[model samples]
Target chain A: SQTIHQWPATLVQPVGSPLSLECTVEGTSNPNLYWYRQAAGRGLQLLFYSVGIGQISSEVPQNLSASRPQDRQFILSSKKLLLSDSGFYLCAWSPTGGEQYFGPGTRLTVT
Target chain B: AQTVTQSQPEMSVQEAETVTLSCTYDTSESDYYLFWYKQPPSRQMILVIRQEAYKQQNATENRFSVNFQKAAKSFSLKISDSQLGDAAMYFCAYTERSQGNLIFGKGTKLSVKP
Candidate 1:
């Protein structure tokens, strides 16, 4: 069985502060990783996705970025956060042409 | 571009009853996949069920079954003998054939009253 882990299940950051969220998958290799954000009571919006290491595809233009540093490790970062950046950030992994498996998720509050 | 729609924003059902959530999608591709994901207050997106476009038979997993209407471009989820734990926000999602990204709808909040 494969399990996905994300760090800092919840966080509160001041505007203009740096942000970093990590996601890793265990028991799977070379899986597709994705970054999504969901506003309160809203559907998820895909931010970024990576098919392989060092290859990230951004779905929407935003202040955040994602990196696939390793086969099972993915990182979402931002140099300076904005108030609008606050949301429920989620990390998901999927096998090639397979359904996605989501992590526990990180709730970010930009104050 | 593909678009998913869940008409009901919120619905409630009594425990031990049956409930069906409606979903419809717009896409030009013939081959793709549709999925229903449940998000509890805990905020984890759990895959409830999935249906492939090429299949005619409805996909069923225990008490959860999908009504896949290919001709109408509608995919609905039916929960049988609903339990209190079935209360959650149900989202309808669509993925392109051989593609990785999932396009999701606004989601419907299902409340199971005990």
Candidate 2:
């Protein structure tokens, strides 16, 4: 079975602080990885996706960036956080575009 | 560009009753896929159901089923005997036939009352 793991279930960060959220998948290799953000009571917006290592495709222009350092390791980062960056960040993986499997999201609160 | 629209922002249903959530999408491609995802208080994105646009038959799983009308671009979820555990935010998403990413709609929050 494939599973995704994300760290820092919840975080409180001050404005202009650096941020890093990591996601790792188990039992799969070369799978597609995606980063999404959901505002309070809103739908998820795709921020970035990677089909392979060092191949990140961004859907929406934002202050954040993504990197695939390994076959199953993906990281979402920001040099300086903004108040608008506060939201529920999700990490998902897919195999051959069938369906997406998500991890327990990171609830980021930027003050 | 593909876009998904979930018109209902909030919905409520009594326990053990049935409820249907509406979702519509726009896409120029003929072959694609539609999906519904559920997010509980835990904030885990759960795959509810999926329908391939090329398939004519509706897709069903246990108590959850999708009414897929490819011509109308309508895909709705019908939850039979809705349970309290079914309460959550439901999002409708669309993806191209070979695309690895999904385009999601503003979700609809479903509340199940006893």
Candidate 3:
């Protein structure tokens, strides 16, 4: 079975600091990757999505950016973080025309 | 752009009873997909059910099923014999046929009482 993994299950970063979050899929090649954020009491917000390597689409424009360095590896980074950047980050994967599978998620707190 | 709406911010049901969570969407395209996702206190997002706009028959998985009214653009989820485990924040999502993006609603928090 295919699985998704996310690093730093929980993170605490100071304001104006840099940010780097990684997501990887195992047992699946060329899968669609997505980055979503859930605020304290809100729904999932699609931040970015990638259909293939080196291809990325931004759903919402902000301080965050996403990159697909490899076929199954996606990275979310920021040169400087903002206080509003704090939220629960979820990484998901799906096959073309298929339902998405979510990773364990990373709770990022930007103080 | 496709949009999903879940009017109920919170709902509660007695254990072993049935509960229906309402979800409606708006889209100009005829070909699309609707989904219901469950997010537990653990914060993991899980797919509860999905309905294709082309399929007239509602999709069902075990105790979960959908009431898809394509013409009305309404897709509601029904959970039979609701259990404590069923308590969670349920979100309604939509994705157009040609798009890879899944748009989500604000979500409804469901609580099960024993």
Candidate 3 residue lDDT tens string, B5-107: 9999999999999999999999999888889999999899999998888999999999999999988999999999999999999999998878868899999
Q: Extract clashing residue pairs from model 2.
A: none
lDDT over C-alpha atoms for residue A36 of model 1: 96
Superposed on the true interface residues, model 2 gives a C-alpha RMSD in angstroms of 1.1
A1-111 per-residue lDDT for model 1 (tens digits): 999999899999999999999999999899999999999999999999999999999889989988998999999999999999999999999897557999999999999
Tell how far residue A101 is off in model 3, in angstroms: 1.2
Tens-digit lDDT track of model 2 for A47-110 = 9999999999989998999999999999999999999999999999998876788999999999
- All candidates: CA RMSD in angstroms? 0.7, 0.9, 0.8
Candidate order (TM-score): 1, 3, 2
Q: What is residue B16's positional error in candidate 2, in angstroms?
A: 0.9
Error of 1 at B80 (Å): 0.4
TM-score of each: 0.99, 0.97, 0.98
| Lowest-sum lDDT 10-residue window in model 2 chain B | B94-103
- In terms of lDDT, which candidate is strongest? 1
Per-residue lDDT tens digits of candidate 1, residues B2-75?
89999999999999999999999999999898999999999999999989899999999999999999999999
Q: What would the C-alpha RMSD of candidate 2 be, to one decimal place?
A: 0.9
